[model samples]
Target chain A: MRRAKFKAAAVAFIASATLASATLASAPAQAEIASGAVLANTCFSCHGTDGKSAGDMPTIAGKSEDFITRKLKAFKSGELEATIMNRIAKGFTDEEIAALAKFFSRR
Target chain B: MTELTRRGFNKGLGATTALGALSLSGIAPATAAGKAQVVVVGGGFGGATAAKYIKRFDPKIGVTLVEPSKRFVTCPFSNTVIGGLNTIDYITHGYDALKGLGVEVVHDSAAAVDGAKKQVRLAGGGSIGFDRCIVAPGVDFRWEAIEGLDAGTAARIPHAWKAGAQTLLLRKQLEAMADGGVFVISPPVNPFRCPPGPGERISLVASYFKTAKPRSKIIVLDPKEKFSKEGLFKEGWAALYPGMIEYRNLAEDGLVRRVDPASRTLYTDFGEETGDVVNFIPAQKAGKIAQVSGLADKTEWCPIHPRSFESTLQPGVHVIGDASIAAPMPKSAFTASTQAKVCAEAVVNLLRGAAPGAPKFINVCYSLVGENYGISVAMVYGYRDGRIVKIEGSGGLSPSGATPEFRRKEADYTRGWYESISRDIWG
Candidate 1:
């Protein structure tokens, strides 16, 4: 069991290093689109981009990632009452929700 | 489901690697070093959002927004202005935010496009070149479709579709109306901007009558059999403004063949109807600039590739907003902004020689049925088989028997949505 856990950690480390290198490699060529920003942009139609809201809509920028994740999951599951967020949240996959949470949280 | 294992996660990354490799080969080299010129026309929701997003995606791409007007009045919440719930200034915005974002704001109309030369001619005798051009001129009324309802007559029987002086005119007419007066709203056929717009206007007018002119009646003459959020609008009308509002479908005395603006009478196939105030929303086509520039094809609107929103008829130019043929997705400010982002990404990817990613579009239209009562319809769209198709099991209408509290919350959401979207475009 200890050997297997060590192997898994090595594989994870290698994978992350490869991704980081690949991102750096593509940065100069401008071949990689900002996937998180592009995905988060869709919300700009109803929520300002980078989560800076203008009116009654609360800003999501700088919020805890866990808080956004919990609120989005509640919206997705229809547990929390919403006007349009429920329907919108239902459209995102779990992967997309995490990506969006990470994107907005960083802002 | 359990969390993805390391192997599974690595496999997903491997797929992304393949996609990136493909993108590297697919994109062509951009024209200039360190600065790519992206020109956007019409400074509305689509153009403004496209300009903002393109700059956000890559600061190196210099964006120039060409718009004749300095201030943009949104159509989303203009109905509330007509209903006396909000003021026009509340829906109006300026382009200062976009300018502060390093976008070159050109206060001039685009007269024509030299597509081959990759340049746009200004109406007031100037020319600007572009590496990529995005046109989002919104919609223009087809005045010839209705007899005696040209621009001059429209001043008398206001359409209030463009959300400025027309909106104020309609409000003034409503205010001048008698207590038991009749208010007539003639809605054009499908494929127009904001499908639920007429219905929402009717609700707001009814709300105003309930308080100001209780005996007043509203008549909606629709050219279609059904409308967006039909059931919800009907239910709210019945519950809130009982016996005060009447909806006539095309099959039932709804089609207005002609109008005599001098008499304030609308002649239909069934009979003649007069009103104290008339709103004649005429048939619509792509904005005049799209047609004159050869972007619009045989269809009244411009045809575009569903994925890139680039005009299929005109290369090197992208068309968005109500002017593009984006059916299944209604012609709305929200859809325009959404399409703008997708188009912006495509433009950037193509400039940088990267493959454009798959496109997903979402539309949520909220309609206020009465004071503190609203309903909505939402859908998700995916590009497949060379066309945009609705995603199954995603998005639907508001519940049929929702509580008043739910509807009131929706109303609040409507206001919030307007604030959010307006700021996204102009703030």
Candidate 2:
């Protein structure tokens, strides 16, 4: 009985999402907003969820967007001393850095 | 039968609802609403993180994580457990936190995946359907590759590869041995789980022997010529446990053709060596489910789309972690969790009929040369023209000439990483 309901729900969701995507596909701006959320998620592995640190790693959440962008750029440029951040910072583009910074700063 | 594409899906959206009627032929619970379902197989670093991130990305999507084990013992710090610096409990995690996150946790092994039918047949019986599926079964040992080593005989030799009981067994074996006894550690060939694992294990076990059993020695029969953090590990061994560790690379006749578990002996190409305790990590491939489900190809690993980790062979199915052929990105807890997030986001996007976003992945692996000594290798990966490649000038090993204090700080950070990553994924 439970299995049948799950199947029904899954089909409905795909149907709704299909209709929803018609709208999302037309709007490039909405794609960016969603993209930013996922790009910043990669950081949670080390930096903690939503950029909050649970241990010795520094808390990236609650920081200013400008602070994040500047620090990341410095790390990328090798202007800042880092253990692992320098390598990670180099992987992101200026735009991605901005998105990540914006994502974390809001938290 | 009708085909479905993003461009033409709108026309067939009506057929999707009619398909729901086809599903009503079977029994289904009333609570299952019109939420898209994602079934995640295996609850290790990959599956757990994928489940969490999928919900994080879209709470409306229903997620059911299928794992056989109730508790997850991380491979990351299992070396510390063997070294006596930590206990198994420190590295062990429960699924309660994941359960608290509104994920439907199913304690069952996945028996088969019917991709065309969009259903996962469980070993416990019954089937769960999914709009998308994520398989993160980690790695299973290739017992046939090594003579005298199979699941039944593993207890005597103890791979300790999967942690939990095996970890305790290996630790107990080491503890039972006398001070002057020899410990033999043999690492399998390339593309095994956790590239830095054996190196770290050798270092930690040496650290253990250095204190409690000063006369004890370690013999490493490595199949590969070199390993991750090779320079750092070699330097640390020379400085800390000089003359206590002997490393024999493949070219030096370190290949073990067979194991004599009854005698605790390893038969290498040159000669057979007996030890008080033997740790043999056998050659590995994607977990059994991957092969049975048709996710793995001739390589015995799943090939995935570079951008989304979706299986190239099976659409709507994403394979991540040790099960996938993601070279340049070594199989570690960090990479598994990182891949999980990328896959989760991709799955969410696909379910929503939106294209997956451009992905960025990072991997940081820290190995303890001793209790207060640590070294790390890190990389930030990006999608290139057709594959995942290391971002140039982005990541590398720790400085070879670092001061003791720097090493100690890195060791501290190792603990911090374990805590934060655990919280992020299962917390």
* Tens digit per residue, CA lDDT, model 2, B1-427: 1113332432232233224324642322212335788899999999999999888877777899999989989988999999999999999998998888889999999998877688899999999998778999999999999988899987899999998999999999999999999999999898899888998999999999999999999999998989889999999899899999999999988999989988998998879889999999999999999999999999899998765687878766789999998888998889999999988976766554454555678889988999888889998887655568888878889999888988888888888888899998879
Poorest lDDT segment (10 consecutive residues) of candidate 1 chain B: B1-10
Task: Name the lDDT value of residue A14 in candidate 2.
Answer: 39
Q: Which ten residues in a row have the lowest lDDT in candidate 2 chain B?
A: B24-33
Query: Tens digits of per-residue lDDT for model 2 on A1-107?
Result: 97587456544433332333344343211232255676777788778899898887889998998899899999999999877778778877776677677779999
The DockQ-derived docking category for candidate 2 is acceptable
Against the reference, the lDDT scores of all candidates come to 0.81, 0.82
Q: What docking tier does model 1 reach?
A: acceptable
